[model samples]
Target chain A: MTDRPALSRVRVVLVQASHPGNIGAAARAMKTMGLSSLWLVQPKSFPDAEASARASGATDVLEAAQVVSTLTEALQGVTLAAALTSRRRELSLPAQWSREAAQTLASRAEHGEEVALVFGNETYGLSNEDLRVCQLPVMIPANPAYSSLNLGAAVQVMSYEISMALATPAALPVYGEPLATVDEVEALMAHIERATTATGFFNPANPKRLMPRLRRMFGRIALERDEVNILRGMLNFFERPLPGSAASTIAAPTRDDGKA
Target chain B: MTDRPALSRVRVVLVQASHPGNIGAAARAMKTMGLSSLWLVQPKSFPDAEASARASGATDVLEAAQVVSTLTEALQGVTLAAALTSRRRELSLPAQWSREAAQTLASRAEHGEEVALVFGNETYGLSNEDLRVCQLPVMIPANPAYSSLNLGAAVQVMSYEISMALATPAALPVYGEPLATVDEVEALMAHIERATTATGFFNPANPKRLMPRLRRMFGRIALERDEVNILRGMLNFFERPLPGSAASTIAAPTRDDGKA
Candidate 1:
């Protein structure tokens, strides 16, 4: 406990931030709220004197920040990416309110997942292109009349939400046993698709557009580690073994041939 | 709820110790752990040169500490007092393991009963006379082999225990409405005693013996504010209603009626 920390397993990425000073201020806010992993994506100006000066005692965050060229580069191995969006996007990604986003992101972080909360430029929020790139646009609710929150305030709100969640461990239900990890989730979807291609969940001729909807529901639950294992265990039971089909396997079922 | 502290209330009392510095540290612990209204009975020194310095940023607590000449004086007006003992005590009224004692005292504190937790002197714990004054001798379980904790640490443990009991009352019963406050408890006790004395459940001439035992039983449940009001209402129905019969009155009851 003495080690306390700069919060681990999560990173804050600000994209195309116009001011170096805002970067410093953002760093200060993150440190105050016990978050240190910061990522700068294609900042207009960083490593500037003004930005570092405003950072105050949060020089550690600035020194450790990873400046990347693109948002995709900022993400790579990230399991969950939440884009900060000011306006409504046309794409049908799930729009999570603040508390929902923070809790979901934090739960992922707890189980050693790389969760990236990506912020857009100061002048304009995540571009529609960036929003499309994100898994979800995590919205910050404000007075609709004037809902522009300063960059630092946004970081603080997210930090506060996550901190509260961590402090109260038993807030959420234990949800069966373990939640499915990204890999397990992918495997489960692949198995489901392979098994029922004739009756596709995502039909191509007149695509039903059902898989994305399923993803949204599962994502909302903020699945935990054990819960994932339980789910995968259940899914694996229904999954075709090895060759994916009983007939295709060495120990293939003769029932289909016998019926024919 | 905001204006007045709950009826079953917590009265945190610090004890005499070699160093005056720990008094402030104890106060800080009490404040953060959500226990306030400190009582200091015969500290080695008060308003000491080093106490405030060691208190860190918690000066308000040190400023509010009540310096009493004796433990009895501190216990006076206190209906339920728990003498926090690190080990065991010579004169024990009822044995209170930390959780038990904390719930009992915190319930009384909230109900507006004069509840108190008395810590001991630094080097030597509470005196036999001091222990005798407490209705319950609360022993905080630490590492039995290496259970030597500083006065501040003792206070912190007691405070944390009280907080746990108050924060979530799972130990009491399934989802209670809420715990009563000190005022509510006092009112209920007064009303019950009034009706009991009239109906001869308690002998008006000498109410002492039955009253203490009744208080003991009531202190155990950790009743919520509403529960206290309910009990008080029942008592009020049995007894004659007076200006103070509501039990919502904030004033401490006079006339001990301890002779019974």
Candidate 2:
């Protein structure tokens, strides 16, 4: 096939998929649509026969698929990632229909921006925690009566749509600053967690929906690298106390990593 | 689920399919798209364990499928049958890209015309004979280098397209006399065969490409019932010996069915 730079930049992340055959079939689906990058987050089995048999001629994709332990690791350098969620969640970014989401992902990928399409397990689907870090929510418009498409079929449809969108990619508005990488977003979330705990605004012991809400808010922002830096700086100031002030008299909690 | 008259009118026909598992997967695909009618033409095996296992929750569709011995039998009562052919053939009608065909099928179904989407065996897609009878040809646009979609995947994509089209049907021009049913077209072809043989215009003993060429020609016309009647009437008149002409003394070939 001709070089599809956009397809090459898009990674398919299967998170905690239990069925090895499904993983293999998904590999085949990806390859058939000209996508090669495959990231498996905590798959139950990697080189099973069932998966290879299902993959048919696409064993190459399975053989080269990257196995990671976490969705975060799977999304390492991805600038834009969409969580494939069929159900409505309490606080996810408004889900874009598969075609629209494919267009968005394809547009970003056309500009050489690394993007990911994340799929959850066959049974449980993506946990709220898993949906939290992804910048977008994507849903396939299937029959409401029986919308449960097999994992492989879902991958096939999404990949096919993305390939179609790439053929006539819609121009996306370029941001002044590059979007924050997955790692940058993770780091900012970690910093916010620390700052919130230190300031006693959020109690770690009673951490209920606070972190999830914050994650959803940040995910919706599609934070740029500069925005991440500015946010982290503000968080640092909030965590630090003024010298000779009453707040300074009280010692801050110490952590094993040395940052208070 | 609420009634989707268009979906109800559509039937998925698998012809001489070899894989029982693919049969089951195709059932699941149909059900997910709200399509229930399934017609199997000379399947290698049915009611098999592998097929049921692959069907998951869609065993209902498999259990209700109508099994027949030939594509013609499967397409009975179908006003519009599209032969899903990925490969180009010499005498087949121009294949419509899948989405466009779906809109065509959906529009007819919305008007209460029964339609069928026919797929052939995995190894040797639709035979020339099978392609000749269907009114339309449909092709799913996949990566050209690896357009070999698995039987189940192909069904899934086609079903998906039809379902999507049904949701937003395009206004189609209504025609008089309604389209000829598959059986009506088959009868017309049989009459033409006899008429051509009687007039010494076509030698079935050296059939080569005559029948297929005629089938493609008639298929492209989307013959109306009245048109089929008129054509068959003309053939009947031509087949009859000219009054007091020397041709009356010549004997027409006898057949077991005794049409002559």
Candidate 3:
């Protein structure tokens, strides 16, 4: 697979990061996703021992990170910028799910356009002014009840999406067999209905929505072609009596005539 | 949307945790993802000060965490267990990507089956015996060169995926206007081409690759119906002379004949 040079063109910018430990953790998260560019805008504390200690082995990213006075300075030379936020603000930039935003940024970066993903302070998040500078707002669709994603955690999620978008697409694991088509599924259902009717299990004259309920149950399973065939074959066997069986000697039960 | 009761049935298990701080961080990660159940197996330390300090306001989860002596005790009532690992092991259970595994777990949980997501020690992942007991192995696809995802980070990613899988799908933020259909976009492109040709900016007789490139650029934007109309209106204005312009006398430049 070709290396995604786009990952290098993308910058991860943190604005007014108050915790040095979070900065270190974010750096580690970026490195794990094969990203190296880091920009700090008006951080409260930098060149701190705690940041380096928390970085694990990603000190190289911290050492080479660019520190700027303002978010605008951090976004210098960036063609596109996306602001990450958890809160929904009125009149903010158009918001996209993190995955969609990652794809857009990767596409632009692949075409040699510089892209920046801006993060906000741990507690307050991005201000309206900070959000206005960004063309898009990206949100991680976390649980609504408890959506307090730590700064490093949020960065990790974003980086993970960006890496997955840029990396070669992996083929989804194929289970047992291909799923049956609509026609095949319908055929199986019809066969089962016919078997049930012949066996007096279901009366066609007074069917009380049993067939539709069965259809829904089968629909949920999404059976494969082979499974459908096996089920139909079972139904066919049930439609007939086994050789030398007592059931074959017995007459079929008549349907209830309206009399209680 | 129906609420996903499965989230409540899922438990997060950390085995042989060496650092008390990681335990706290993991609890915070779980809470952020809306998971409450936490089980610890053979942890080196419990009720430690470091753990409480790092839990960041998720002390409730830590306090409610179940500390057990063995992995079996931790998985007491789990109907489905997924072991999180970074390495591929032979003779292991079916391995799935983290997201896929989360979906499976969530589906099972929704059906009232208890589910457990197990994580191993920080230094060494799950042992072979431990993995054998689990029904599935889940791997997070990080950068191949540096796949050292911290334990808390790994927990956060898994929790995020699981929470997303179980939560009701949130509506994507709608921007200005609905996107144009393929035919509408094509018609708009044709109009622009005609206008550019008439303005002497492009020649139909010797049409170069400008039209195709322009189409690709517009395709990248995925313009809305309103955007298409605005572009065509601008093109129409460009085709004719300005209100007071002198004969629209801007001469078309000759094509570069490779003589430069």
Write down the C-alpha DockQ for each prediction: 0.01, 0.07, 0.10
- Return whichever of 2 and 3 wins on lDDT: 2
In CAPRI terms, model 3 is classed as incorrect
DockQ, candidate 2, comes to 0.07
Q: Could you tally the backbone clashes for each prediction?
A: 47, 0, 0
Structural similarity to truth (TM-score) of each candidate: 0.38, 0.78, 0.66
Docking class of 2: incorrect
Clashing pairs in 3: none
**Top model number, DockQ:** 3
Q: Of the native A-B interface contacts, what share survives in model 2? A: 0.21
Q: lDDT per residue, candidate 1, B109-144, as tens digits?
A: 677778888888866888887787778887754333
Interface root-mean-square deviation (Å) of every model: 28.8, 38.4, 28.8
- Tens-place lDDT per residue, model 1, A121-233, is 86687875565445657775432323445455466556555554554443453334343444454555465444334322224565343444334334434444544444344
Q: Tell me the spans in candidate 3 whose CA falls farther than 4 Å from its real position.
A: A168-260, B173-260
Write candidate 2's Cα lDDT for B1-260 as tens digits: 34787898999999988999899989998998999999999999987998999899899999999999989999888999998987666646667877788899998898889999999998899987788889888877666667667788888888888888887668875865477899999998798677555544557788766677556545655667766665565445444443233333232333333783
TM-score of chain B of each: 0.60, 0.91, 0.67
User: In model 3, what is the error at residue B204, expressed in angstroms?
Assistant: 22
